[model samples]
Target: MFPRTLLCLAVFSASTPLLADTVWLKNGDKLSGTITVFDGGKLLIQTKYAGAVAIDWKEVKTLDSDQHLLVKQDAYAGEVSKSLTAADDGKVTLANGEAPKTVELASIQQILKPKPIVTDLVWKGNVDLALDYQRAEKDTDDYDVAFKTSARHGRWRHTGEGEYNREVQDAETTTNNWRAEYSLDRFLTDQWFWQGRINYKRDHIEELARQRVVGTGPGYQFWDDELGAFSLGSLLNRTDYEYRDGSKDNFYSVAMKWDYNRYLIGKKVEFFTNGEVGKPLSGVADYALDAELGLRYKVTDWASLNLKAERDIISGTNDADLNKTRYTAGFGVAW
Candidate 1:
């Protein structure tokens, strides 16, 4: 019995260090676990006993955490302050407290902590898949899958996206398209940024087997709030296209890109559009454009329904197969 008791003591000591964070409420209540997000208006936390809980930030009297957090300090005299630090005994002191800036248990913008693999990279990602199937004398099967991810550290952010789509009728392949893009951005200020991008695409129907583009330029973020975000940018691109008929060509061009999104109903519904246009320095087809617009209705934590339309057009020349439009509706998920 004495040996068993000693074993239990050892086990408890080993488990103590991984215990959850703690929150003390104004109503004399305490919550245990990690805080997921603590904006000025609301706080979301995950706990072993309660899975996840949302608390009014005003009701939180104090917090005790070792998690690194990004806090948005209340502005004063037209000056705003921000920091990345850990909490200590319900308060955080920054820069000798000259301003004596005390954090109100609320108003934390984001939380990011370094871990073995994930947080070290500060990454977030989503994967979505859409499928359409029709059964009859002639069966149709079409699928679209996309993966998007982004990571940020300091003033730099990196984003990448990959997509694969295919369609078949009566077991005969009708469409096959794949694309990938990667971009890097450096924030010059709140409203301006510098960016560089690399793009690759392939299409079977258009007789284009491979296309690669590299561009670099500046961008603007006009609006980024609860409503959504709006951004526009332009770049000078070097493009190379390889056709299925063993034909290849390369050129230089100027490209413009715009992306926008809005939340329509609380956090459940969203509308988004992404588009780009490029004008070749010298070509019979002077310009090309690509655009995608979509609406998503979230159904569950990991699932959502979406409707989308996509268009691609080339102007000043007559290549019938080079321009196409498609509409799709299906489901998507994120992590």
Candidate 2:
């Protein structure tokens, strides 16, 4: 009888999934799973029986976990890494080394898996391409390719973006231009940073054949999380322009730049916009704007369809005034 009991116990243990985390719901239901993340008022968990599920944060009554998690509390700027010990209803104890502290679960704003080390690198980026061709009244070919990437480690962040565009009509190149920009940022605080950037643009058909800019400024990071991020910067720039006729002009300018993106509908769709507007300090040009806005519908984890509109304007330049806008649609991969 003892041997039979041991065999039954072993079989039961083998059939049950091993879950290190558990949450007790307000309605008296309990669930065993691995916490994926808690963000935007939703707690996501992965369970063997039900796959991944999202529960309203308000529905969580108590929780315990053996994993190291980063818990951000309300009214607190920094994150805490500690074990979660179940306490009273709607509360948990943080095993904060020597002193264990209990806090209301409602006061927790965000929960995530803690990185192994502070200095570990985090990287994310995407590339997109659009192409068009026609064989009607006038043979035409168009191509647009753009890419943006960023990487961060410790207190430093690096960002870069570039685009190439070309169009041909009747076997003649009508539009050809390419631009690239790179920026480096050093964080002074969680939401504040200093940035230095350089940009270059070249056009094969336009009167303004070459453009170069260098800038330095301070930027504010509103927020960066699993869902989205936004940032704004003010820059003092020195811009140089060279025309197709070989005339060159340079001037200093002040500019405001913004980058924003948000994920919606369970992160299946994304809306983004980034742009810069500048006024020359010396009247080199009345104003200049370079901007793009886009929407991406994620088809899969790493694949998406994108539509974008871009605008470039240089009003009242000494040699030539410029205004151009373009629209594109394409499919791309992301990571």
Candidate 3:
């Protein structure tokens, strides 16, 4: 009876220890505890002291001290060969035994699991709609409605907005404006990237004027993971403006803009400044300088509220001297 009891005790001890086993490899690396999940080229191991350690499956040498494990049993557990080669492009190539596979890194979706040391792709978009009204003591009553959409996929992004405004006072007038922009960002290093963008805008005011502008430029990006990013760029704009009373003007502009953004509470706050100098190409205009300052508060994932003030520092023609200050406040939505 005592021999049978000792046998049962030994069996329980071996099974229990295996359930909480720690794998010690020959390469001086130690992995404590049992592995719970293995997927997406990562091993989710739950340890006793270090909590969870997600080690790259490709970096692992052997498992359980079994030579048979070296055989390629599963797609995720294939044996890889390591090699070092010199390329003609002056770049050193370090090859692992695994065959070069075309990974859809851009389409990867990140999922959070039991253990949390993995990085995943982020893609999102939002849409918003807003209405605005303003009353100035001396000017006309201003009303506006806007729609906007913003989207990001991998390192590419796009934004579009359209707005309709009416001044319901002595000289009633309506205006419509639309803007669309697309940008591509390429990471040159961990903290820096190159950016390129194309933008277009059209504005029409009832019986007063119509204008169209198109621009494209390259820029630089400085990103702070927690504090957002700052960007500086120069754009070349070609504008065609026509007035209601049979007057026409054309101009070319070189503009510089700076953007700053930060997150506060659950909202993103952005500040922007734009300065442009325009040289007349035809008609009765000389040169013009314009400046704008604006602030935006993100209200939702797809909507924001903004306030802006603009001034024309130098007028191009005596007939259309825009030496007055203009203020605008509105809400915008994007999808």
Candidate 4:
């Protein structure tokens, strides 16, 4: 009877279900699995619905019962009101309310959504072509083309962009302008990054000949990983330009940019503003300043359109700085 009792006890212990604290080991490798049985240091792991795996006790170093659970959460929490009802003619009428608002669905050219999948490391390229017809104090018509590309790997990022412009007026000689810039950025942390850039510019005016400038700068980035991202940065740049008459001037400037994203015109819109203050190192230009504002809409996964306006508020040392404004509208594509 004593032998029988001992046998029964051993059998019961071997058949008992192991708790979450149990660990399994096999061939010097330790693993955590739902344990089904333990007998004299041998472990039986319940690997899903597929039978049990036997492991030796000597192979396990330790067992961890705690497991991490990852839960996905939505980021957008705001509610959109759909109080307007569409009519048969495609016009929308607002429901009776204290502040009634109505919109025309037919007038909506496109609908855009925020792209959460676009990150800093996606290989992409874009080109923009625009024709600007402007009648300033002086009549000016210009054609512009811009191209940009970006690539990233781990913590390093590279970007390059260039622009070409041609302007014609009835009285003034045709002017040709071109600018190119390249930049590299390195991420130091989730929120902090640093960048270095080089820029070159050339302007040609008939007999007045040509002018050229080159500049370089280093800047910092404050970034957030979320929709409607924002970044603020400042740059210190030095520019040297040569004129048609064999004259040259050197200038220094500090520039800052602010960027934001929002919903506009039934589409996602990106906006940015930039300002710069420049001082001359030599020549006739003592100080110069400029400001620019831009907006873009994503038309598709690989296409977008943008509009920009810029003002040159200051120009030279002797003459009062003349205000020059430029407007551009262009389309961009990415791959």
For all candidates in order, the CA lDDT equals 0.72, 0.88, 0.48, 0.53
Model 1: how far is 83 from its true place, Å? 15
Q: State TM-scores per candidate.
A: 0.73, 0.77, 0.47, 0.51
Model 1 C-alpha lDDT per residue in residues 1-335, reported as the tens digit of each score: 99999999999999888856677777889998886764335667788876667777667666656555544443111112233233444454322225635554444443434445433245655677889999999999999987777775556779899888899999999899999999998878766889999999988866767789999999997865445578899999998878777777788899899988886765578898888999989773578898989998888756888898989886654233377788888888854
Alpha-carbon lDDT of model 1: 0.72
Off by over 4 Å in 4: 1-120, 132-141, 170-173, 206-218, 224-228, 251-267, 279-286, 317-323
| TM-score sort, best first | 2, 1, 4, 3
Residue-wise lDDT of candidate 2 within 1-335, one digit each (tens)? Answer: 99999999999999997757999999999989899787667888888887667788899998999887877773224355578899999898888799988888888877777666742345778899999898999999999999999986556899999999999999999999999999999988778999999999999999999999999999999987667899999999999999999999999999999999998987889999999999999978999999999999999878999999999999999999889999999988887
Model 3 score (lDDT): 0.48
What stretches of model 3 exceed 4 Å from their correct place?
Answer: 1-141, 146-150, 174-208, 224-226, 266-314, 317-319, 328-335
Candidate achieving the largest TM-score: 2
**lDDT comparison, 2 vs 4, better candidate:** 2
- What are the clashing pairs of model 2? none
Global Cα lDDT for candidate 4: 0.53
Error of 4 at 237 (Å): 2.8
Query: What's each prediction's clash count?
Result: 2, 0, 12, 0
Clashing pairs in 1: 40-107, 97-100
Q: Which stretches of candidate 2 lie over 4 Å from their true place?
A: 1-120
- Model 1: CA > 4 A from native: 2-34, 38-110, 117-121, 223-228, 317-321
Query: For candidate 4, what is the TM-score?
Result: 0.51
C-alpha RMSD of each candidate structure in angstroms: 6.1, 4.9, 13.0, 23.3
